[model samples]
Target chain A: MQVTVTTRTRSSSIAGYAAIALIVIGLALPAFASRSLIQDLFFILTMLTLAQLWNLIAGYGGMVSVGQQAFVGIGAYAMFAGVILWGMDPVPAILLGGVAGFLLAIPMAFFAFRLQGAYFAIGTWVIAEVTRLIIAQWKTLGGGTGTSLPREATSDIMGVEAIAQLFGLRDAAARDVLAYWLALLLAVGTMAAIYALLRSRTGLALAAVRDNDNAAQSVGVDARRVKWMVFLAAATMTGLVGALIYVQTARISPDAAFSVTTWTAYVIFIAVIGGIGRLEGPILGVLVFWGLQTAFSDYGSWYLLALGLIAIAVMLLAPRGLWGLIADRWGIALFPVQRRLILEGTRHG
Target chain B: MIWLDTVVQGVLLGGLYALFAAGLSLVFGIMRLVNLAHGDLIVASAFLILIVVETLGLNPFLAALVAAPALFALGWALQRFVLNRVLGKDILPPLLVTFGLSVALQNGMLELFSADSQRIAAGPLESASIDLGIVTVGTMPLLTFASAVLVIFLLNRLFYSTALGRAFRATSDDAVTASLMGINPKSVFAIATGLAMVIVTIAALYLGMRANFDPSVGPARLIYAFEAVIIGGLGSLWGTLIGGAIIGVAQTVGAQLNPEWQILAGHLAFLVVLILRPRGLFPRAVD
Candidate 1:
């Protein structure tokens, strides 16, 4: 008799093949897709990135933050500062945004970490608002009004010309293509990084801490360090996404940059609705969210109201999310992170 | 003399912030549920009062009397039906549910009110003021301050002196044990929320009178209330008032130094306080 441990399923392998095919098609999309379609894909990819980072912190790390916009805003600002102030290339400046997010997380964690549960959520929001207010006073960055990326920074960005030459596209189209490629890379990179992390030892520690901090601590999990690391990593990734988003838009404003509705609320909705704590959930969630937007956004506030109602209904009825439902019913996990032991012959030792 | 006037005015302004926090503090203290929709609910109550005022053409205060009970019923039903189900060990469900509620309420109000900032139009009461010996005070601010005090006092009375209050304390202390004593924690929670809604009505009345309110103003108001509750220490009613005053003074003082610093200064103070006292200034002794 033999026992075997595995994290893979037959469906998972099929899902992997499907994923490779999807990537192949995605890479070729620019050749056939309309500009608007490319742009919409960009939106979906960026949103999916944001949702994944948020899911990591809240779902696995047990820190429900309502102030993630703080990082997004800061990251966007940092990228702008990098290009405008230091004359750094726009692409390199985005990495700076991640660093800025990491730096900002220190003080944020300092204040927010003291509080527990719901207070932590509100505390983060307050800090974000405060950050917005302070940034609004900076006369250098267009103050409260915000500013656009300089033409030199946007048009003459590193690799724009090369990308244009390679794609045989004009300048504007080239920039869009470049941004689209970056978005694709970011989306894929973020998902792969998170998936890899979840399969690692630290990921197990994170789950343990999330389930019961005191108990995990008794088991020597170092819950504080785990939480700190998770917060920092999420902040850094969120910042990178934020910077990348604004780089594509080429404009920034404090209010727009720090918008809770866009950066935090929508991401939370995506993660929660799609099935939080699961790697595949945010992807499905973003698609559904985008679908809802396209189908019903013409109704304006009613659409938002509907989104809210759906979110509430999901939280109450299916706390595990839509994918959770499918997973439970079908026993399918495209990106299975949970470990399962199989008894080959069930022999007595 | 100017400094004295500013401090006094800030203290009066603190009363309004305290009013905003009272219901929030009460609900949080009893249930351990942070109602993300709390600020939106306050804004919604303001709208409810506006509808009553417009339809009946009654005085806003008189309208508040009508709005309060209606809001109380709304709160009761919300807690009994919606919130109570999500309550228990896992904190995420209530937080997310309330967040959804907040978004729905905001957009719903926006749809109904059309993003317009509306006021209660108190007729001379909006601008009327009385000269104290050292500083002049607006009639509305004074009334707001007095009402905040009265609300807190009544709440304290209810929380400490009544059988219902006893039930609240018992449930809050240990819901399982309290249930063994034949008390229905769900009803207690519903009643507590109803009481909180009444306070929210009071806060909404002054908010509409003293300032313009639109659907989107709820989250900001929630921030102010949260800061006050945290500064005062969780579950400490009187501490909330002092916390509100602290934020109020910080804002005013910052405004005096540089107008742009007003909101920033208040938040800085909150951070400083948080750094100094992680659990809040007056945290409850037990979890």
Candidate 2:
């Protein structure tokens, strides 16, 4: 009980400091950071959000979904409708896009959740494709051509041209700035939410479920419910990221919105390499991944092949992930969720 | 009458969908590894066949035969070397590994083949059609549908009647137990993946024969196969046929109603089925 009290106090203090830091940084990012840096950060933030959300489901909840792109697409299209059709402001519309994803997920989860394990993973992909086809068929959205945001909505928050000149990015400036900052905030928010969830009782339940579903169920944990809840949460958050992605690019083609390659390929790679089921792994992973992309992206298509090889090597050599290895090696936990329960000797008891 | 034609064509088209899904179902049924590379492998096979046909001036169908054995070997090697290491109590490793592999394969193919779309030119067979009493059906599609049915039919026989099926099912049921019986679980998995590759080769035959394909087409094919597998039920071969038919009918009929409705129609059908029967049309495998 004493330990619990100490931990709680410590956690609250950390949360407080983190919140303050974030608020300060959030406000300052637009002003302090160059547009190019902001843009790069935004893209990283988007990946962070996705990795965190995926980490929650696959890492904590034991659902290794390959279909997070489904929610991403749903969110994008919803935003498209809100902005292009209803003329809603992009920010609020983006939130609504998340709700739209949530709604879509309700029906999606029903189909996917029926099967456990691999079926669940495949079910999510199938669901995403279904959404894609449905969206693609809706002709007004540009059909196979895919839809782009109306020019007014995105053509230019895009102070990149002005900012890019500062950093020597002649043309890609506005794009770099808008995309970068947006990605950064979203990623931070996702990580914060996931960290919070892991610390909460619900997070414990999810971890329990991941460790052993039967055991979790025996302990009065509704394993299925936890899975569903997290699934929905992950979907909603990911879908929202999808919105920000297209908003930055000013495009929402079914192919782009539902592109599995974007998330499934590298998000999984990042999380796996950073370490699955471990907090801070994805952060490390995203850093490493982007670093590799920057260094090796010139390999063009072979870059994917190399990434695949690296991921496989990492999975075999370090299944615990890079962060997992660090933690295991040093007994460190940056975002530790485990409780410190004290036990007395049986004889003393 | 036109609607009748559409319905018939959809049923026939369902056969192709079934073939696309059969190997996927087989792999999942045995070991719950959702091969993200499954569809891409099909595209890879098509490319292989295209190369063979284009270079050798052989019939596309004949080239498929040559490619099948090679794909099976490729699948065998991949499983024996790469995949076997990843199968585990933890599912994410395999999924991620495969996801990475899928990306690698796509980009690898792109680098080697470039992004230009290629079709396996089939000469007169490409244009051939059979006039049924109600409507005319393309000979190639009808053949594709028939091949799908035939593949499923044979697979069903193998699963129920053959010793190999027993090995596959037993391994799927309890890999540890199967090992105790002296069955090499790893070999079983390798064979299963190889067998799936063979099925993929068949799917490739039609995919190449029917339309133009590029390196990027694999993931989309994977989606179709995945949907069919789920809609049909995870492990049921025949159910995959029905699932494919549902998707096919929805797409064609939706297109019939409004040319723009084709894609939407397919997605709506999948969504509707998912909502109504989340367990799918036939669920033979369990988590």
Candidate 3:
């Protein structure tokens, strides 16, 4: 019997429908869920978006960066500038975060791209620090201190009124709902973009580069261009998510905005433990992380200690991560993008 | 005279930065493992010294003597048990594991020590300065610089003139080949990390005495160490000293211009160095 290749699998199709159902439920979540629950989901969605961006760059692109907070802080600050300085609507300002990130990424990539392996990680971190220190000097944004969204800006934010009327909720709750919706839209859009990209020819090139750069070059994959593309795209999405995160908080400061521990380290923890190099990994990682945080957050440093231990254990025991372990055991591919061969004369299904 | 003083002060400050970067360079050169927890380990060392000083009523120097060996053991255990497993073809495991370690170390220090910044009381040395005709220097800064020089000198001797150093170099060149020649790569790595931790102990002593330190200060210290290492070249010890001096001078000069520009100036110098020499000012021949 001859073999035929296909990207689709029964499980993948099921996962696609499952994802659609999730989106629909997510859209209606604000209706029945409490304001706090909506707020919590906003955190999850934004964090999921951040984790996915990190997975794309580090996991798939093979560029490990510990300084993604650079984009996050810059994006947040840009959004703040858009709303506070230029009097733009918050919705459009969020998009400006992505633009600002993209703009900043050119110079950053030029500098950081010069280094390889571990140095690249530190190089990005140093740039992030410089960015934070420079941002702290802008007196218009409260300088070293920080500033919150103006009363008029937060009160009259776009879509808040409509959301309030539709849900019969108060202004504050409406703002939360609106931010939640934007976060949902952004997360869904990011996942879809990543999904579509991974299925394209460029995705094949990315996988090739990740597996082996020299071999990819030997095969004419243009590794450098692909890396630059992945880096810039990750930065833009991270910036957007960073902006949305601050929009929900309605305040911005250099420390809070550019915190490496909060913005970068935690994201790494999620992606690594959930599984790197898989679309399902970050989703699994975030839920586990969030669950761990909710359960043991009261213990303070012990919570972080446990996280460190778990990450190390997973790295040693199952470097492929939790989802990887499950996939290996059950032969499941929830979002299988890789091609596989089947005997043409046989009906495996 | 003012400019001379500024330059001299910057050099002394660079001594401290060099001390911080030395351990980092040693480990990276040997294993190619960038310890993300490095700055936190420095902070953790400071806490170890502090505990000895506070509880035993010993001076910081004596406390450091006690803390160094303890940290050596910790480093050795960490490398042998934790870091060695993650050191392989893929770079992500080491980076992620160390990143997690950084998080854990910082938070653990916070829980143990609280967030309050602490200083090691250096008695009369804290304010003592000596007058030179052109530039006056603080006694502490001078001692720190001397200690830094001594540490580098000793490290150089150990690396270049010792049998253990030979094993280190050989293992670093090719682990499998070194193993074939009767060296244990794992033990060599553990010893290298142990040695690095001793340097961290010295850096921690000055770091505590020089400024107020809390648990969260580790990452910032790490940045300075990283910048120095990059400016100097990744694997060169002497290069780290010069890089540290450059940063120290830039920061002092920037502070002279405007206080806010001090940190930014050091980073700018690093960036300029990076642009001019991507491999660093003194890149090793092998790389």
Candidate 4:
């Protein structure tokens, strides 16, 4: 951190504050906007959160996990169990889903951690499929058909609609607005957490592991444990976002829950296009991706094909991704994680 | 008596799965690339055989022979031009690109063939069967099983007994180092994919004869293939054979107990294998 904290930096801080304010305004927009528009925005933000979580693991950590959807599925099924069966409240139940997903990830982390590189990707996918098969026949949890979340789980708090109203989010005219606001908050929180985590000692170790596992382990870094922890963390975050996705939609099914489609294709596309290693890459990737999806939604598989073509083009032309290229060319540091020495020379405190 | 018949049918059915897994194993063993598009490539070859069969009115085997060379060329070009570029230090690039290719192929096939499921009409031979006292098995299945064994045997011979196969092993061990030893890494990969495509053509022949296939069937077939590979281990070719047998047996046995268990039982066996030996039953020394 530059100790001088330039006027430009101050202005940027103010810009961030303004951005938060705009989100707060958006949260209260239920009183103003159309129902459908808000709903679409909600979906976008939810997807943004999911993509961002993936970006952290695969992009920054350099752990390309094709099976984050497993955590997502676990999260959704956890919601089903917590809200539908255990009678937990909606908000708390979502948290429970996250926790359950974390617990599941821990054991999975132990097993899957043994596999390196592409093998790990396959391990994660296989684990997700196994979980799907188990839950598909559980009978109590809706089997392959799926089960519904009680509206009470996601609706008003303590039996009153006003509870949602208190946070400047009312579902009556704008469930989309409420959903958007929630997604915004989650996305921001995820960003902040990633930012903070990346700045930590362990984060440096994780980065080192990504650069070269043997090199990282040479100096007493337990690369395996660090990788496992990162995997678990990724699983937990993915699970939380997944719970939010299903909670917003109010339903869960084995196919939809465990759909690897929901996780990899877009996230990988977004992360790559936006530039993988940087924090801002996924954000840029999501906006561009959703924009394309919005435009090409009607073309069905053609849209998917276009996405694939673009990903291939990107990999060939600009492997560093969009924002990554920007960061390299412009020497810009929006969310700077690297240490830079100050001219002041007194530690810039 | 009927139970014995079903079991025999299941054993033969497992043979087809073994065929599916064989090509997949060859590719994976030589090049660690997963080839997410493998199933589609299989289907695509089947369509090629179908077209040749219809066009020349040639026998199905001759059509396959005609198509195999063309498929080999196509696969060689794909590996050389596209896949070879992405094979490097990071595995994700190949995975992502292949996944993209998978999507593209599925869409392309849908556009050309429509969504209708198809089977190559193998004419009267499809109904031909051999009865061995306790039970009878379709000629196609018997041929499929025999061919699977033959394919595996040939692959083994190639791997253990040939100069080209030795070059393949050497390349798999270390691409750069092998380059120092006069092996062209790119050509090796291209030939390997080409060889795998020949195997893919074999798989397509059996798949077209025995089951309905559309573009989407590739992914499901991929799942079975993947399960077989995992059950067998990462790199050992022979392990893939046993893996195919286990899945085939599990599914058939499960179906014998109850029909719904066909798919589920195989999945359960996969899970059981993973729990017991995450490295698979016969993990390769290197992997």
Candidate 5:
């Protein structure tokens, strides 16, 4: 008798094909989609990226940071500084956001990691608040009021001209297209990177650490290192998404950039409602979030109230989220990480 | 002389922060549940007091007394119905649920009250002050400090001298063993939360009178309370008071240097404390 270890299931294989098709459609979306549609897609993709990274740290790494806005806000500010201060193009400036996020994560992790469990969440939130207050002091960036990207910076972004000509659209619309493409690329890349990481040896260590830190440490997993790595990676990706978001708006305010409700709470809702600790969860969650926003956004605070209620209900009733419910019922895994032992050529011993 | 005045003001401010933190500290000590919605609950309690004062034409303090029992019921129901179910080994559910509740409460208040800042009108009492020779203090602040001390003192008495306090300690130490001894952990938790809400009502009275607040201010309040709790050390009530004072002093001193550094200074002090003493100044919990 022979046995094989495989992570893939029959359903997951089909999901792979479906995912490829979806990516194709997403890439071609700007070609035919209206400007508003592209803008909406941009919102979805960027949020999906944020949700995915958040899920990675909280869901997988067991570090539930409520201060992700720190990374996002810093990343956006870094990109703005890169363009306004350093004379860099906005496209290249996005990478600066990633760098800034990575740098901030070092000190943030150092401070926040001391506190365990729920206290950790509060620690991160404090750091984010400090970051916002400090950033508000930057007089060059319009101080507390915030500043907009120079008109030329927005119009002359690297790919905007090419995209404008290729799609036969105006600069503003073309900028949207460019930002949408970046967002789409980021979303896809994040999903792929997370999938690849989860399938790696380090990913196994991460899961082990999350399940039981003491037990995993007993089995020789460097839990601290794994957590730090996950935190840094998540922060970097979050920073990139933050920069991209501000670039799309072309306006950066300390309040808006570092908003807990917009950056952290909403991302958490998407991750939790779609499902935590699952890669496919954020994808589905972002879609659901976008749908809710489109339908109920006009109601103002009531919309937020509804979102909060829904999140609470989901946490209470469906702790595993919508995807968890579906997966349990159907035994389907679009992004299966469970290793199954398959027995082949069974013979009488 | 100027520094002494700033320090004095900071101590008084710390009393407000301690009021904000005492309920949080109590709930955490009893159940090991970090109520993320705590700040919003304080805000909500304030709004409730405001409504009571406006409708009944009562003093703010009297309105808080009227509002306290109702808040106690709300907190009791909240724990008995919502939070109790999520309390367990995995910290994710309680954290997420409370966070959701916080958002919901904030938005609900926003929907009802609008974004405009509102304050509880205290008439001349709001502006009345007392001379201390060296440094004068506002009557409201002086009262707030006295209330904070009284609340902590009473809470200590409730914790050490009462049967319910024994149950809280037992449950907090080991829920399973406490349950084996015929204590209903769930009911105990509900009562603890109810008590916490009573403290919150007191905090709310001072908070509403101290400054104008909108729905958005709840998170900042939560941060201040959290900082106090962390600075004091987990499960230590006196530690929480000291922690609050530290933050208050930091903010006042920072503001003296530069107005913009006020909140930032408090947070920086927290971070510095965390770095120097990760276990906090008076950590009681072994874990």
Candidate 6:
């Protein structure tokens, strides 16, 4: 008899092929898609990236942070400081944002880790508030009022010039295209990274730690280290995404950049509505969220109210979210992370 | 003299924060649930008082009295119907649900009452002051502090003396065992939430009279209340009051140094407390 363990499933194989095709289409989308379409896609892709990173921490790491805005705002602010203060290109400045996020996560983790459960959520929020308040005091970057990326800097951005020549487009359209592409890369990269992490040995240890800290520690899993790694990684990626978002907008204000509603609340909604703890969940969630936003955003407060109600209903009725419902009903595993053992000879004999 | 006045004002300010945190402490003590929408509920109660005062031409205090029963009923139904269903070992559902409720309540209030900031009119009492030779204090602040003390005293009395208090302790300690002893944990939770809402109404009364409030102010209020609860230690009422005073003093001092550091100072103080004593100043619960 021969037995082997496999994480692959038939659905995953199909999903792999579908993902390749989607990537190909995404890369070529700028050729035929309208400017508005590109911008909308940019929004979707960046949001998807944020959702994926958030799911990695809250869903997999068992650290539900409500202060992700701290990273986002810091990243965005760092990028702006790079451009306005150091006269660096916005593209490289985005990396500065990621580094800022990573640096901020160190102290943030130190403080927030002291708290447990729901208190941890509030602690993170307090830190984010402190960050915003301090950032508002930065007089060089227009202080609390915020500043726009210089017109020359934005128009003469690195990729914008290359895209302008290659696509025969105006600077504005080219910038949008460039942002859309970066967002696509980011979204794909984040998903791939998370998927690979979940399939690794560390992933199993992470799940163990999340399920039972003492049990995992008894088995040699460094629970705190794993949590620290997850928190730092999420913060870094969230910062990168935040930088990319602001680079696209070319505007940075303390309130708008550090908005809890836009950065944290909306991201939480996307993760929760799609299906947390699964790689495919955020993809499904971002689409539903985009659709709802498009449909109801014009109604202003009513739109937010509806979203809240829907999220609550999903939590109570389907704790697993929309994808959870679909996966359970169909036994689907589009991105299967679960391992299965197969016996060759002794199956039914 | 100036420093003394600042300290006096901070102590008075602590009274309001204690009121904001008292109901939260009560509910958390009874059930491990932390309602993220707590601040929003306080804001909603304030709005309710505003409506009663406007429509019926009643004083803000009387309006709060009228709104208290309604808030109690709302809280009872909210816990019985919504929050009770989500309470269990997994903390994710309750947190997410309350977060959603917070968002919903904020937006609902926004839709109903525009974005304009509103304040409750308290006639001449708003500006009335008292002189104690050392430092003068506003009459409203004095009244608010007295109310906070009275509420905490009554709550401590009830918690220590009543059968319902025993039931709260029993459910909090072991819900399954308490159920076996003929105390319905769910009903206890509902009554507890209702009682907390009544306190929220009182907090709302003072909140409206003290400052201007808008729909968007709830989250900040929540952070303050949360900091107070954490500073005081979980499941300890007197600890919450002291926590509130600590934050209040920090804010006043910060503001005196630089107005921008007011809120930042409160947060920093909370962080310092957390660093020094992660379990809080007077932690009552083992967990």
- Among all candidates shown, the one with the greatest lDDT: 5
RMSD of each: 1.9, 4.2, 1.2, 3.6, 1.7, 1.5
Model 5: per-residue lDDT, tens digit, A1-349? 7888888888999999999999999898888899999999999989999999999999999999999999999999999999999988998899999999999999999988888998899899999999999999999998899999998888788978898889899999999999999999999999999999999999999999999999999999999999999999999999999999998989999999999999999999999999999987888888888888899888887877778888889989999999999998998998889888778874221
Candidate 6 per-residue lDDT over residues B1-287, each given as its tens digit: 88989888888888999999999999987788889999999999999999999999999999999999999999999999999999998788898899999999999999999989999999999999999999999999999989988999999888879999889888888899999999999999999999999999999999999999999999888889889988999888999989988999899989999998999998999999999999899998756
Candidate 4 ranges beyond 4 A from true positions? A1-22, A25-32, A87-89, A149-160, A163-173, A345-349, B1-11, B47-62, B111-115, B124-128, B274-285
* Estimated TM-score for each candidate: 0.97, 0.88, 0.98, 0.89, 0.98, 0.98
**Segments of candidate 5 deviating more than 4 angstroms:** A346-349
In candidate 3, stretches whose alpha carbon ends up further than 4 angstroms from where it belongs are: A1-3
User: The CA-based lDDT of model 1 is what?
Assistant: 0.91
TM-score of chain A of each: 0.96, 0.86, 0.97, 0.88, 0.98, 0.98
Better of 2 and 3 by TM-score: 3
Q: Order the candidate numbers by lDDT, best to worst.
A: 5, 6, 1, 3, 2, 4
Q: Each prediction's DockQ?
A: 0.81, 0.60, 0.82, 0.49, 0.84, 0.83
Error of 5 at A104 (Å): 0.2
- Candidate 4 residue-wise lDDT, B1-287, digit = tens: 87777767766776777788887787777778888778878888888888898889988888999999999999899889888888887887888787777767777777778789888888888899888877888898888878888888898899879999888888878789999999999999999999989999999988987888887777667777877887888667678777887888788888889775677788778768877887788977465
Error of 4 at A268 (Å): 2.1
Give i-RMS (Å) per prediction.
Answer: 0.9, 2.0, 1.1, 2.0, 0.9, 0.8
lDDT of candidates 1 onward, in order: 0.91, 0.81, 0.90, 0.77, 0.92, 0.91
Q: Model 4, DockQ value?
A: 0.49
Residue runs of model 6 more than 4 Å from their true location after superposition? A345-349
